[model samples]
Target: MSIANQIIKQFPDLLIKKDEPLSKYTYTKTGGQADIFIMPRTVSEAQAVVAFAASEAIALTILGNGSNLIVKDGGIRGIVMHLDLLHTIRREDTCIIAGSGAKLIEVSRFALSESLSGLEFACGIPGSIGGALYMNAGAYGGEISDVLNSATVLTRTGELLHLERDQLAAKYRHSTISEKDLIVLEAEFALTLTERQPIETKMAELTEARESKQPLEYPSCGSVFKRPPGHFAGKLIQDSGLQGKQIGGVQVSLKHAGFMVNVGGGTATDYLHLIEYVQQTVKEKFDVELETEVKIIGEDA
Candidate 1:
């Protein structure tokens, strides 16, 4: 029997898809396929899948909302796990507890509905709660680390753990999740009680700022490079005259140099080549290396 069949047989209740095209999931709308894709609805189901992958010596890839990620044309091997069905959001006193699959934007809106403050900056972030925490996602002047109270995570070995904010070691676009190969299941945020009017105003202002500056009309992985010390990635790219530069179907966003958009029919190969070209051009002109903030994974086609 094939591994996909084996997976279904092992977990009869779980939804499983074979040779699924991952482009349907990624925000950029560009990717190859997954050998076996599974979305576990319950925590126990997730743990079981992790255990199965480990015991069977099959590779496992954890994919969140895929807002800031790139999967190459060669696709991912073995099991690809997504947590979309686990999305749930609720308020607990002065805090909001959200499942990993919950979008940051939704969580922010939830906070607004409850008259809770502190998630205003995430009102426009496209990633899921887990993806936001993994990258310490930030916008304007706020970051996930600022309001995060705790998180429930599962190690690669399928051991569940609850961790405090300080234990996460979160920094600019980084956290211990990647280094430790941990998968976030849920996150809790401590918020302040505020008037609904102020929250609405803040969200509206931020929404306007983001919409005006970003290339939201096209498919793109938000923010290609990390901010270097004392310098902005967008400014550097813009100064390097990289705006609207095209390679294959992907092009450097004219609205924002930090983003590479799939104009139409863009592929993963196009995106990768454009990234390399931008890095090279920026390095040659400014003597600064543009390190990628977006997670690039899977194999080359």
Candidate 2:
């Protein structure tokens, strides 16, 4: 039997779909499909799927909230797992324990409700806890590395491991999790007890700033390029006169040059081509190399 067939046989009760359209899940609303899409509700179920894939030598891709990712037009092979059902949050004194699939916005709101202060910067981030930790997500001068105390992860071989903050080696849109291909199961954040009003005020301020600056109305993978050393990606793109540039249905967000928005019915090929155009244009104009911050995966159509 095929790997997909084996997965179904092993987990008959699990939510599994074949040739699932990844476009429906990604923020860009583009991409082809996944050979097998599985939504695992429990950590044990997730582990089992991982172990099965490892045993079969099948590719396993963790699809987080799809905030900072772009799936290719040809779609992903093997098993694509989404942990949305794992969304849960709990508080222990000044610490917040969030499941990997918990949305960052919800986590930040929970912190505000509990009068915890440290996650205010994540209020506007549109990714899940696992995705955030994977990329060391940051905004408004705060980063995941600043507050993450520890995390529970499933190794590539399906063994559960607990790693401390120091062990994560999180820095500037990177973490050890990506290097080791570990799947985050849960994260513990060390926050401070604070007044509710102040936390709400900060969240509001950050949200307002994000709304004013980002093109949130469109379908985008958030910031496309990382900030080059001593230079902002948006500023560089804007300075290169690449704002409002379009390739197929994808356009450089007029609101923020850092974003490449899917105006309508865009393809991954369009997105990738536009990225290359912008990088070449920016390099020619400013002589600075632009690096992508968004994670592009899967085969090309």
Candidate 3:
């Protein structure tokens, strides 16, 4: 039997598949394939998967929403776990306990439904609760650091842990919580009750800003680089005259220099080559280096 067959046999209840096209799973709509793709419905199911992968020494990676990631055209080896099946949300007195797979926008809407005010910045982030917390994702001058309470995680060895916000080393586009195979299963946030009008206005303003500033009409992994202090990365790239540049099917967005968009049917190689080109051009024109914000994973195409 194949390794994928073995995996399904071992984890009977998991939604398992073989040779699944990764394009269906990613925001970029590009990638080769996944050897083993599994979506576990319950926490116990997720834990069981981790244990099985560890026992077999399989290469395992968990996926939340794929808003800020790029998978290579070469399919990933081993198991690719998805937490979307674990989506659940519960409201506490002044806090929300959210499942990792729950959409960030869903959480924000829930907060609004309760007349809670603190999640306004997350109203437009197109990712799961886990992905947002993983990168300390923020917008409109607010960050996860403001409302994060704690996380329930599963370690590499399949042990369960509860860690506080500071313990995760939450910083810009990173967290130490990911150093191991620690998967975020759940998170809690503290919020406050407020009137409806101001909250609605803030959400509308942010939505408009994102639509106007980002290349939302195309396929992309969102911002390509982390902000380098004192200057905007997009302005620098535009000033270097790299806007609308193309590599294979990838093109620097004329709409937003910060965005490296897949104009149509672009490959991971195209996107990568374009990134390198922009980086090289920016370095030659200015002394500053651009650091990538989106996490690029899987093998080279």
> How accurate locally, in lDDT, is each candidate?
0.94, 0.95, 0.87
- Candidate 2 at residue 201, lDDT? 94
Query: Which regions of candidate 3 deviate over 4 angstroms?
Result: none
As a TM-score, model 2 comes out at 0.99
Clashing residue pairs for model 2: none
- Quote the lDDT for 262 in model 2: 95
Q: Is candidate 2 or candidate 3 better by lDDT?
A: 2
Model 1 lDDT, residue 109, Cα: 98
As for lDDT, the candidate ahead, 1 or 2, is 2
Taking all chains together, each candidate's TM-score versus the true structure is: 0.99, 0.99, 0.97
lDDT of 3 by residue, 106-176 (tens): 99989888888899999988889888877888877888778988889998778999998678776776676
lDDT, model 1, position 94: 98
Worst 10-residue lDDT window, candidate 2: 1-10
Clashing pairs in 3: none
* Model 1 per-residue lDDT tens digits across residues 1-301: 9999999999999999999999999999989899999999999999999988988999999999999999999899999999988899999999999999999999999999999999999999999999998999999999999999999999988899999988888889888876687999999999999899999999999999999999999999999999988899999999999999998899999999999999998999999999999899989999889999999999898
Least lDDT summed over 10 consecutive residues: which range in candidate 1? 172-181
Better of 1 and 3 by TM-score: 1
CA RMSD of each candidate after superposition: 0.7, 0.7, 1.2
Off by over 4 Å in 1: none
